[model samples]
Target: MTEPPQTAEPSPPSGAAPAPGPAPGVTADGGPSPQAPAAVRRRAVLAGTAVSVLLILAIVFGSRLLRDFDSALLPYAVATVFLAFGVAYRYTVWISAPGARRLFRQGWRSFFSAANFRRAPTALPRMIATYLGFQKFLGARSHARWAAHQLLFWGCLLAAAITFPLTWGWFTFTSATGSGPGYEMRIWGFEIIGFDALGFLGWLMFHGLDIAAVLVIAGAAYFLWRRMKDRGAITGQRFAYDLVPLIALVVISVTGLLLTFSSIFLHGGGYQFLAVLHMVSVVFTLIYIPFGKFFHIVQRPAAVGMQLFKYTSRRTGEGEGEVLVCRRCHEPIDTAPYVANLRGTMRDLDLGFDEWAEYCPRCKRVLRGAAYLDHVKKGFK
Candidate 1:
């Protein structure tokens, strides 16, 4: 009988070092042999701290600019410009990029394709999943966190959408009876929607907004504290992006809550000042949205759409061969370099002539072939 072909030796266990003993000061688990220098970490923390301080200053002073604008028209114009620029930037970077656009197309195809529709059957379940799984769909955070974020995100969006049309009288659908169609529609819709009972809804929405604001502010604050306390969480480079939105959100939330609840507490002449301050916060937030993390609002959805389209296209065979699968985990590997490395490692490992399969190094499980193929179809370039 022919001898079995010689099999390569298995790789050393992941945590095992080649040497007989751990390297000097190295952990037994074979993690990095050297810790980052304490001085370097300290500097990083200090830098993040400074950026956080500057961000706070910017928001505090930026809102003041809105207070000085005497004509209400200019603030609205500024807000519109900011919103436009933000949308344009995100589109160009994420939605219009060649790779991203391809993915976006696939997403649209997937949504409109008969196969997907037949598989899903009802639109309501898909809609509910979309609503509840926003963060998961975006790959941003968990469901609960995403839900909290959506409350603030949609609230702000809805508020802005309604405010603009109602305040500017933009729609032409209503009778041209001197009173703007937009205004008439707003009143009609509000009444018909039982906004007369909006007291409860308003309270709920505002409370939700307040909670979201707190969460965002708390996250920022934690980052800031980490910069000061832990020193490991920051890169030390101070960019406007680092803390500006955090400060802005905090300002907006505090002022908004005050405007609604504490307006009566303002002393003598302080009422006017407080009212102006509150409005200034609103205006500043509107203006800042385009320039900050808030810009993610537009970019995220497009990203999701692009992802969907990319998956659909691959499923339809508009691209290359079978998607790469992880040999160790048996799962589909994306174009990620690390994943490629894992596959290469698995192929090098002689595993008793079983067909090559993708696998997750972390879990070390052989992913189902069909599932792996599906993943590749969705994410492979």
Candidate 2:
């Protein structure tokens, strides 16, 4: 389960200083952390059990309700079931991955540690800004790509927030007499809501999705242009990788807009067809979420783990494990174990000529440049 080796070259010069590694005492015993106490384990097991039962009931009833509305919606019901199953399956796989379990344990311990409590106040806001609000971490030098991503991210966020609940049967709509197809959006079968209401909240409930759809279209367009027009940016990406999500988003947004148009101009005259198209596109997208780039949705918790374990580990200052520092930049890069695995992999592949893992990325780039210059000098000689 070790990470692939990063290098096969000789170790750093003996004179180089070793800096702080990952969390000190993270693996003092040279093995995984001890299992939690029985009581704690039992409580976790019970809570997980209860949640699983509720989820099963919700899926069963939710599918039944959708089926009652229209037999054609069965495809959507099936897709939902598959999506749920796929999410659970992927989570299990992630948990079983190397270092993942240990990372989870460390993250949980860090969260509950009394000394770290003071930092908690700013953590949530910072995390949201870094990972969700702005996603500044995505591209170090690519502003155009990042802008396109931000549009897609917010659009999908808005769409999912509104769509999931209704699709799950937590929300419904009731058609007015002779309205003939379109219906008033309702929450929990009690509150009558729709675009018809002449107020701010009403306008949002009805038009929020439309706005989101427009954003998705814009984002998808940018993405398509990048893939087709800007070849360098999308190098190494497969055609399907570039097209599937883009196509899916465009179809979902376009169908949604078309449905709204049919409802307003045609007085729900072709609403049935538009609804069917919208439903199919949406269901397919939902099914694709856990399996495609949308799978990033399920990795949010891991983002928190990255913050907890990687960034905050050395803060304790006790020195539990060997920390890897960039010999040139003098910046902490990773734990010894992490770099060891990478070095091992590269060595195995005969690609570790310069011991690349010994240096941080910036230093690695500098080293590569120096090597190139030396080669050029030799050629001139």
Candidate 3:
């Protein structure tokens, strides 16, 4: 009888069960159960997807507005701001990193070194030949890709050369010259030579862009698909930096093609719109250039230049005889003689070896030795 009474003494209030005692998967404090970390990740993915969609829509609509706006000043303002930002970013990065700053100093010192100009007179010629002639003629797989990149780069440069001068008449007329120079001379001298060249190169560049876009998009898509298909490739810490550029590049390519071919179908008298959008895209690309993966364009060259100078200095008996350890193979090697020969060859070629570290005519890696050897072996085979 006592045991039966004790059994009825303490039951959890109606539906409750001691407030669950913070259950197996729950945090302390009697609140709703905690969610799985995966749930939070899923929520983030959804949010990112929504944001991306919004961005795409904004780019589409905003680009259209570029045409009808009566603001002639906006384009120039945007372009200037973009250019300034790029310069500022580069400067900041260059100054902030000790390695980068050291490289810059080395590069500058090499450029002005008496030995560079005296014994290395042919450096400049060698650089030009290697870059323009030999690299172009050999058509090595890597070299070919580089040439295509250069073509697009130069085309963009020329297009900008034509656009700014024409847009602001900065080259044609200035405060110094009231009415400016004659139109015919400007057209013949600047337009035909500069603008026409840009246009022709731009047309060629469009083809290059198409090819590049296809390759890049294919590569990125393959990677993304692989991440989904292969569990081994998936990691918890997937970087947005990796995906953003790939997506942006795809958008750029698609938009560029639309501007080229689909404008007429989509909007009446949309040529102006296309032009403005193209210009805006170019500006956007420039603005992102220093911050994104595209920063490689600037950095690669500088890295190459630094390597070139370092090698050349060692070879020419200009360094302190410190042996270089190959980063890849961990092999210790004296770089002096190789650097000397390279400098000599550069002198003979009349190219500035110090200026073009990014290229190695013999090996094609930024620096000579093991990595270049590896590249050669893999590339040729």
Candidate 4:
């Protein structure tokens, strides 16, 4: 008795392509999408890289203007250039990692926010103390590990703090009035920072470096001990992961100390050979830092950014768009794209963990424990 009213469908224009269905978890309006358009992302990455390169070049040019780029400094300059290239390549690899695009988007927004700026003064101190100073959280779990890290950390940091600027020509020795190898450009102005051009400051630099050398040696010794004696702590340790960096650090530190000692004790006799050894050691370490265990330094800043964003989001009642939460912990995990990629990877590997991909670290641990108990109970039955 009733003819249902039929809705009319609109037809596509003569040569038009059919409208594509929305991708999984993507809205028609494109809101809450985990990734932006590829073109936009590429542009953002390129722009950021360009700015960094430009800034580095400006600094180099300014340094050249401030001081002569003499033959003695030429090798260091080339090494610095290679170091910059290594950093850039490593950064590119990081940004290309799974979930990195979304993380970077959130990080960029958070970094420029006024709220983050307001919190910076207080937040920076905590970051420096907790992260840069001792890595206190790791210390809470293992004192020996923490002590080793602190030694390596501060030794590298202090050395870099002084050396980088000196290499960049930001500091020059007033006592380096002659062009010979005996008078070298120094870090921290020869006159400024309350040091006479020749005597006390040079002594301080040498002793300060010696102190760093001792710390590095102690740290390397601890690591080597752990590798040899405490095998349980490092389940799958490889030589590249454990021994190589440790050995390299030890060699670098020992050679540097030797150079210092030779200068101090031998009145710089055979200084040429010592200097060459030190230079080669430093160049190798610099080349290796971006690739190996030293990447921890780069990752630490990323961790801080993530921490700051999380803190800001909680404080401001703002949520990262399309947030996925852990099933057990109730904490936010990664965005949809990351979860999707993870699931795809698991499926490809036949891991059967597609459903568990979004679980946070704490939730994963608890769930694993529960599964173990269930397995034991069934075995007893």
TM-score per prediction, in order, is: 0.49, 0.65, 0.46, 0.67
Q: For model 2, how big is the CA root-mean-square deviation?
A: 11.6
The sequence of per-residue lDDT tens digits that candidate 3 reaches over residues 1-381 is 223445647744556445644233222221112342454445544554554455434433433433322255356545544555454534443433444555566666777778776877777456545654344533564564454445444544454554443443333311224332322214212333222223555455335545554554554565455546666545431444344555555565556566656544766456667666756665676566655555554555564456557655665764565554444444544464444444455655577554443233443354555665577675545
- lDDT at 266, model 2: 85
* lDDT tens readout by residue for model 2, 15-125: 655564533343332221245445544554455455555655775565454442334455665566667765655454444434455556566776776776664556645
**lDDT, residue 134, candidate 4:** 68
Off by over 4 Å in 3: 1-73, 124-240, 246-257, 260-268, 271-280, 318-381
- Provide the RMSD of all predictions against the true structure, rounded to 1 decimal: 15.1, 11.6, 19.2, 13.4
lDDT of 4 by residue, 236-317 (tens): 5556655788998898899889888788899988779977888887888777776666766666766666666665565554
Q: Write the per-residue lDDT of candidate 1 for residues 98-136, one digit (tens) a residue.
A: 344555655566677788666544543444357434445
Residue pairs in collision within model 4: none
Best by TM-score: 4
Which stretch of 10 consecutive residues in model 4 shows the poorest summed lDDT? 23-32
- How far residue 163's Cα lies from its native spot in candidate 3, in Å, is 4.0
Candidate 1 matches the true fold with a TM-score of 0.49
Off by over 4 Å in 1: 1-74, 121-134, 137-190, 194-232, 236-239, 267-269, 310-331, 334-381
